[model samples]
Target: MTELLTVDGTQSALSQRYSSALMNTFGAPKRVLVRGEGAYLWDADGNKYLDLLGGLAVNCLGHAHPFVVSAVTSQLATLGHVSNFFASAPQIALAEKLLGLFDAPGKVFFTNSGTEANEAAFKITRRTGRTKIVSTVGAFHGRSMGALAVTWKPAYRELFAPLPGDVEFVPYGDAEALAAAVDDETAAVVLEPIQGENGVVVPPAGYLQAARRITSEHGALLWIDEIQTGIGRTGTWFAFEAEGITPDLVTVAKGLGAGIPIGACIGLGAAADLLQPGNHGTTFGGNPVAAIAGLAVLTVIERDGLLAQVNAVGNHLASSIIALDHRLIAGVRGRGLLLAIELTQPVSDQVAQLALEAGFVINNPIPNALRLAPPYILSKADADSFVAALPGLLDQVEAG
Candidate 1:
């Protein structure tokens, strides 16, 4: 047995050691998290924090929930890892379950993460024999080469020059530009039902319908990147449901396994047959453990009526934050639990840091935008507490 290091522990020393050993992608660690339960987390220093970002929208049911834990443990005990040559019941069940959420029948390709799921969709689009793909400006699909080709930001794409070419970018909400961009050679048009990475920018009404009409006219596949907006995070099973359009392909992850790594690309209608057998596969993609976790999450979401809860709490939080009328808060933009509070000044990063010090965890993706993706189980009292603390937090940021 390993001996106990120390009561207080050498967490800082260990963190520095980790910095030396690990890659410098995310910069320095932010007070290494030791443990989590429900919406609260404890750092290595043993200070508790209310986690509002929900691990970047992965922990939908919250941390260490019994259902997720039990499902994972039970599946591991029964049958852990299997090669892609063999199929598992949980994987097949997950595929069927996902397809059921859509009115149209589809096929599923499981992947280990969002980028990989998108990679699968990328290949599917290629099979259409059209190389050009029309994407939106300010879109964040994924970081890998294929997904990166469709992402619009130059900082992320410029370094990796000569990416798979023929990706066209149009203004996100302008149907005219999108319509003007799509031609017969366009394989697909990709969009996030709600642009989560760009400060939760919701498109105008009929924007997606316009996309549907345009894609239909050009025979292009309509792909929805629901990676951050799916699995009841947006008060619906999928954000595209709100748009009232049937997409040819839908990529989902983030909250699929409630923290477990799992992503899926679902192809609907004729697009379902595009990827034949032997086209793509992954060893860990559809493993029984991840599938079990997904099953548990879906079951719980259904049984507890969490979607309704997300709508109610999200509306309450958005309304409350807007009512604060603080100078920093310009507006609250987003749907359901995926909300962002826009600040008048570009001090969102400062506000986030202060909020953390004040025992609240949040995310600041853009300079003047703070994202809040709290768990679907966020209590009304917890929501109120966060709303109550926002004004003071903004004041402190401004003072600094």
Candidate 2:
């Protein structure tokens, strides 16, 4: 057993240890979280906090869900890791389940994370015999070389020079811009149903349908990056369902396994056959453990009717936050549980810090945006508590 230590002492020790052993990729740690349940997390000193960001929208079922835990534990005892050379029941079952979620005929390629899923999709796009791929400005697909080539963030791409060429970027949600970007040479047009990293930015109505139309006109694949929006995060099984369009290719992760680390690249209709047997593969992509975790997440989401719950709770939360009438609050953006509180001033980081001190966790993706992506199972009372505290948190930030 370990002895208890003060919060500051424990946090400082962990930070020092991490700095000495780990790379400075993500900077210092915020706090040392010891435990989590549902929508709340406990720091080492026993300070409880409502987790509003849900680990960047990856913890749809929240931390340590019974279903996920049981599924992972059982799968590990039954069959843990297996090479791609052999097939597992959970793997095939998950693939079928993911394909069924689209309510269409398609194939799936599993991966360990969203970036790898995008990488696989990138390779599939190359199979179209066209080299050019058009993605939106302010769009984030992944960080790997192939996916990074399509990503628009200069800060991330600038350091990694000479990325895979033949990629173009156009303004997101601008139908005319996207229409002009895609041509016969374009292999695919990629987009996010709602941009999560970019302050939970929501595109104009019919934007996705417009992408589908434009890509169809140019004989290019329409790829929707649902890595941050899929698996009922946005109150729908897939965010694209609300757009009323079928994308040829879809990349998903984040919430699919409810923090179990799983991702998939799905191809619909003719695009299903784009990647042949020898085209792509991953050794641990379809491992039984991760597949079972994903299956359990889907099962629980359906069994608990969390999709409708997300829509109802998300609307209530947004309305409550807006009704606060705080001077700093500009507006709320995003759909379902994926939400962002737009601030009038560029003090989102301060607001987030204040919220954290007030026993709530939120994210400041940009200078003027505070993002909230609580778990699907988050109770109304918990949400109301956070809403009630928003005005006070904002007041603290404004004072300083």
Candidate 3:
């Protein structure tokens, strides 16, 4: 054990050291997780916890997946990172693989994370010679300066003054509002098929189709941010796939590389060649290790047929929660492995706390929402275990 975590009474010591050494951005650490396997995690105190949040929807294949581990390690040993200055086979292959997922001819720009992917998309929008962007209410794109400007949280936006301007916010799921807000001179209309960070808030049917129509009519780009809902997290190759609408820009990350840091901003058709040479570049965007990890993840997902499994297990998890007939539960939302348990009362924080104490790792995204984006490999039994314990956790919150 390292000195930071090996001190007497691990939790308290680690907590103090963490506060002193790191900036307090995400408040105190929830738990110093030491190890993870599939859907389970072990903390520094030797407490085992069932991970239902899946690293905030990042770990689609679960923690320490053997295939991803093997691919990344093998690539590292052979040809680690030959910067963008030199082309590598794995990098080219991964890019080709991602583009093949779409029916239309497209090009991809690689990045290190979802936010950077969105940032690249933002720059692509600028190439259209338009300045205005219309996003939606309750959309969580990412936290970087450019992505945060489009994100619709006052708490996040208020602190960061004078963000990139001309960004507009309209009511989510409102076709009229979207159509009205987007007009000529609009660079892009960014949206998520389902707002994952906003407690898995899914939009109305035909929403994406309407968005496509409106943006197309106005000659504005339809940029869909699939950071949380892509990579089979929503039971499809991408959450937007079912809409049958091809977006101009699609930014994907999170589960794309399983747990590895990788993301891509894909441009289809005319939007593909907007960024010219010297327009944008990345130092560690398409490194071989991360590329292999992404390739391995995509390969495993296909070989194991986890997309079908995601739908089955996800449906079972949602249905089981509803069957519990708990008074606190308002309903369930979202599709595939990304789901939210809506509570009748604003006690999600308390319930999540209780759940953590009960050896379950859940997330309270909002006051009345518990978000669950477990791994695609999560078994029905693993989901059932959480459902079995949920009532008691809610009861503890109600008793107070």
Candidate 4:
């Protein structure tokens, strides 16, 4: 006979050791994940989970993809790290491939993470000699001090007082607000096509176009931060592609290296020349291994025709979830695989807990929103499984 225990539980041995050794910046992880293959993760307790969050939208190629692994291993064996003084084939090739995606000839500056990518863009904005930068509300560029300056969340910004000055915020999705905010003094207008961190809030149509017109009119560079929305996450190489406007600068990272650390600040047109020889630099920013990882990620996506797959699977996932007709669900909004399930009740956290216990990984980004940034490789069948289980989870949450 089993005894019913009232006390919840304690951390696993690995988790206990983690608490003592690692910083608590992210709090204690929900599960001590041991391994990953494809879109599934296994914890230390041998519990399997469907990874619907995709490492916060970083693992577009899924986990431990053989192509990326092979590319990184080969590059590391051949030429891993090189000072910025010397260039490598992978770095040059990756830069060229990235620039090819843009309409105009652009230059690429690689960084190790999304924050560093935004940091590079922030510095580029300063090169215009105009200190003021216009950022929209709900914007999340990164955590570094320079990137933090342009970010909108008060809680994230308050601790780091006096973040780079002369930054203004306008209401997102409001073209008129953007027009009113920009002026001759504005160096750049930073924006995210879809506000990823703010519960995957998508902007209305014509907003990006209006932004381009306003920034162009004011002579302010338009910097589009695509860290969370770019690299085929939106069924296109870049989310801004659907809008058909050329941005002065675009920063991408999350899915670029297939889980390896890599990000890039791509400057197009005249913005390409903004950064000169002495303007900026980094040690491992464009290391060959990271560059090769980026190359392999891109190559596989292209070879597999995954953009079409993303669109098909994303449409299917959204439609299937909506088809469930669950009363708790309000709707779903997003492009490609980066979607958000809007809950009628503010019980997303509870629903997420239920989802985890049911062997699914999800994120309650906001009280009423559950964000899903699953890997591009996620099949319709896999998506259907989640959709099938969702009703039961919601029922459990609603009951409680």
User: Which lDDT tens digits does candidate 2 get at residues 1-400?
Assistant: 7868544557678788879999999988787798899999998767899999999999999899998998899989999998998999999999999998876699999999999999999999999999999998899999999999999999999999899999999999999999888899999998999998889999999999999999999999999999999999999988999978999999999999898889999999999999988899998897999999999999999999999999999999999989988899989989999999999999999989888888999999899999999999998899999999898888888788
Error of 3 at 71 (Å): 0.4
lDDT of each: 0.92, 0.92, 0.93, 0.93
Residue 137 displacement in candidate 1 (angstroms): 0.9
Candidate 4 lDDT over 1-400, as tens digits, reads 7867332333387787778999999888798887899999988777899999999999999999998988899888899898999999999999999999888999999999999999999999999999999998889999999999999999999999989999999999999999999999999999999999999999999999999999999899999999999999999999999999999999999899988899999999999999999999999997999999999999999999999999999999999999999999999999999999999999999999999999999999889999999999999989999999999999998788
Residues forming the 10-long window of minimal summed lDDT in candidate 3: 1-10
lDDT of 3 by residue, 4-58 (tens): 6443558777888789999999899988888899889998789999899999998
Task: Please give the TM-score that candidate 1 achieves against the real structure.
Answer: 0.97
Clashing pairs in 1: none
Report the C-alpha lDDT of model 1 over 233-277, residue by residue, as the tens digit. 899999988878899999999899898999999999999999987
TM-score per prediction, in order, is 0.97, 0.97, 0.98, 0.97
Misplaced by over 4 Å in model 4 are: 1-11
Q: What is the lDDT of candidate 1?
A: 0.92
Model 3 TM: 0.98
Q: Which stretches of candidate 3 lie over 4 Å from their true place?
A: 1-9
Residue 323 lDDT, candidate 3, scale 0-100 = 96
Model 4 Cα displacement at 155 (Å)? 0.8
